[model samples]
Target: MGERLFLGVDGGQSHTEAVVADERGRIRGRGRGGPANHAEQPGGRERLARAVGESVGAALREAGLATEVSEVEFDAAHCAMTGGADFKEEVIRSIVRARRLSIGHDAPAALAGATGGEPGIVVIAGTGSVAYGENGLDRSAQAGGWGYLLGDEGSGYWIAMEGLRCALRAVDGVGDSTELGTRALRHFDLKDFRELARAVYAGRIDRDRLATFAIEVERAAREGDASARRIIAEAAMWLCRLVIAVAKRLSVESVKVAAVGGAFRSLSLREEFAQRVAQHLPLARVIAPRFDPAVGALLLAYGAAGVDLTEEILSNLEKESGR
Candidate 1:
């Protein structure tokens, strides 16, 4: 028969990515677009549609296939979107006609990517935080995907929020002083925390920008701010709890855990997560991702198409993806 092809997409809060590959695990093209978590805010649906459209279209163009996303030809297409985007599949199915199509929240893709489609746990702490895992026996569980308003504990957004609170506390003379407060002032170009009121009232920053402040927290922790260190440690504990809970649910004592996203930038956070995981789940080990989330989605699509990837193909995928 003719060459077989597949498409994988990862749609997150900050960006959306699409990859086109052949059955041989050779990447044909890749594309990226704006944030895809549009349903949560005003005029988001349109943005989501555009992001998906742009990414898919760019990928198709790169592959020398049809540049129009709706008309691009592929045997199967799979997508992993932000948690709130349950309807992402419907939107995608309406755009392109593939023999097979699948869509779901982002965690599974990270899990699949981290474990190379094997059963394992994956914790993501980017703009948001969540953990998911599965066993070979079809037993799976997900935890900590709550949005910012409620949960997402240990996420970059959460870290930034924690740092801001710590900074505020330091300024209030009720808590230990920390470099984080000065960092916050610098971030907003203000003289002090009291000046933060003007920016907040004027919409000078939003969720994405707020999450970026997590880096300052990481820096502060690295620079030996005890309060910053505590915040980072607490974040690690929160993430560790997610893995611990997932392992408990699956009844698996020994499992490989993978860390993903921006919150892991701090050495303290990673080491603390590993240490806590060790103390709590002695048999589990935290490891780096073998493939990125997009490839993981592609692997899922391949499975959906009834293709079991051989080790040769897996090796080729890893080699070509440069991950």
Candidate 2:
């Protein structure tokens, strides 16, 4: 084997992550770049190519240096993106030359990263939200990934919007004055709604900025704000429902679930999600992910190369990640 290189890329709404690893699953380099929501983005073809190039190129360079090689050859490339189904393969094929290139949705990438390619479920809540599940038989199902307008009930965007909605309600005298309002004010660093309305009407703030306020909602909830607590609880409930829906679709009595993405980083939210899911579906087990989504994409590459993620190899990967 002449330095077999496998590339895995996770193209997400917020950012793209790429990892370069050897055939043995030893991670050599990791890199990040811009969003790769290719299907919906204007100039999506070029944008997707640029983001994937930047991230994967950086990782490839790092790996090359580690192995004392001036250039590295890619044997396989596996990519998972938010709008992966619609991603034009030519965009990827134009950038990197590999013997084989595989592409799919980001959800399964998250699930594989969370469950180490085992049969399980992965729920993502970041700029967007989605739920993906795979049973032991390799059968799969998904729920709650209909974009922001239709659903995404438990996603970071939803929580941020809820925070803003509640604040607007308070301002309009329809809801109680709670810390959510204060938190929103502080999040934007504005003194009053006049500044907020002016900025919004002027198109000064965008949807991404709105989603950034979700941290404030979590913070206010931590400080015992009732409205904030309720918002977070509702988010948790929505997320839990995704798990139940997937389980029912899979027709499995029990399945391990992995909570992935920035949303589950909150302990309170994570614990609350577990509690709520158990109330309805006792077999839904929520566990921390073994690796990040990009790495999950890398593992998928390993599978394509006929490499099994054996316990020993998994252990080595864990040690490489220092987790």
Candidate 3:
């Protein structure tokens, strides 16, 4: 009859988050760290171990938990990590070894959060993009997320790359001119396309760093810039296509679809994406996530511990979210 604690960790490419909750799903603590995408960073295992420790330790401290809390008191922990299939097992094992917690991919945790642990589809568009669909069973299929070089269409990196392409084209007089060219030059402190190209080619710029241009593209679109507008439209269309594809694959007509990621934080893009989804798949219901992915991770943790989240637990979660 001792108090039980659960932990959820969302290990993302841009950032990592951890949440601690009681058995009743009331959040008691939280922690965060930088860039837990093991596939991208060198010393991946070690970094993940450190991140899990730091995040969980911080959450425990915040929750006023004693350092000597028994493993039995710690009912369960879940980790949602991002990466390709090749890295999935390694990531899970690393997390399990580091935290002694149950772990799953970030996608399922996100999906669970989006649908409140129900079956649905989720499209994540952050540093990367991917569509994941889950039926009533454990079955799920993913589309895209092949990585920056191979795929990840409709993601922040994709949008930023397209923006840069448009900027370069404008500079070369091969496409409609855009302020993006000037903005790109100024943003990167480059004198011209040659300088930008040299820097990019020399690997001076990383994927996430280049993806920072996406916000500029969003701004330009809001200001009626044709090139930026077109890019956003294309990105929206691509993401909608993924949603449709996942829906068809799962054969779950009208399943709830949740949008998750930093890119979706842009109001214009979110509206555009919702419109596109409605237009193409009229039966599907696209919604903003009910909670942050980290919270979703927490839900998964509860499930892993055989703790069924009651309406009271969900209400507490909502209150914590200020919803």
- Candidate 1 or 2, higher TM-score? 1
User: Which candidate comes out best when scored by lDDT?
Assistant: 1
List, residue by residue over 1-323, the lDDT tens digit for candidate 3: 66777777898887788888877778888877777775545787667666666676677777777442232246677788887345545654543332336667889889988888888899999999999989878678888788888888889988999999999888789999999988888778888888888899889987888988899889888998999999998888888888888888888887899999988867778999999888888888987688788889889888876778789888888777555
How big is the RMSD of model 2? 2.2
RMSD of each: 1.6, 2.2, 2.7
TM-score, candidate 2, is 0.94
Candidate 3 has what TM-score? 0.91
Question: lDDT scores for all predictions?
Answer: 0.86, 0.82, 0.81
Off by over 4 Å in 2: 65-71, 85-87, 201-203
TM-scores for candidates 1 onward, in order: 0.95, 0.94, 0.91
| Candidate with the larger lDDT of 1 and 2 | 1
Model 1's TM-score against the true structure: 0.95
Q: Which ranges in model 3 have alpha carbons more than 4 Å from their true place?
A: 66-73, 84-100
Residues 1-323 of candidate 1: C-alpha lDDT, one tens digit per residue:
55788988898988989888899898888899898886657877778888888898898898887768866567888888986655666777777568998887889988888888999999999999999999878798988988898999999999999999988888888899998988998986888665686676577777888898899998999899998899899999999999989999999888999999878877888999999999999999889888888888888999999888889778988887877
Can you rank all candidates by TM-score, best first? 1, 2, 3
Better of 1 and 3 by TM-score: 1
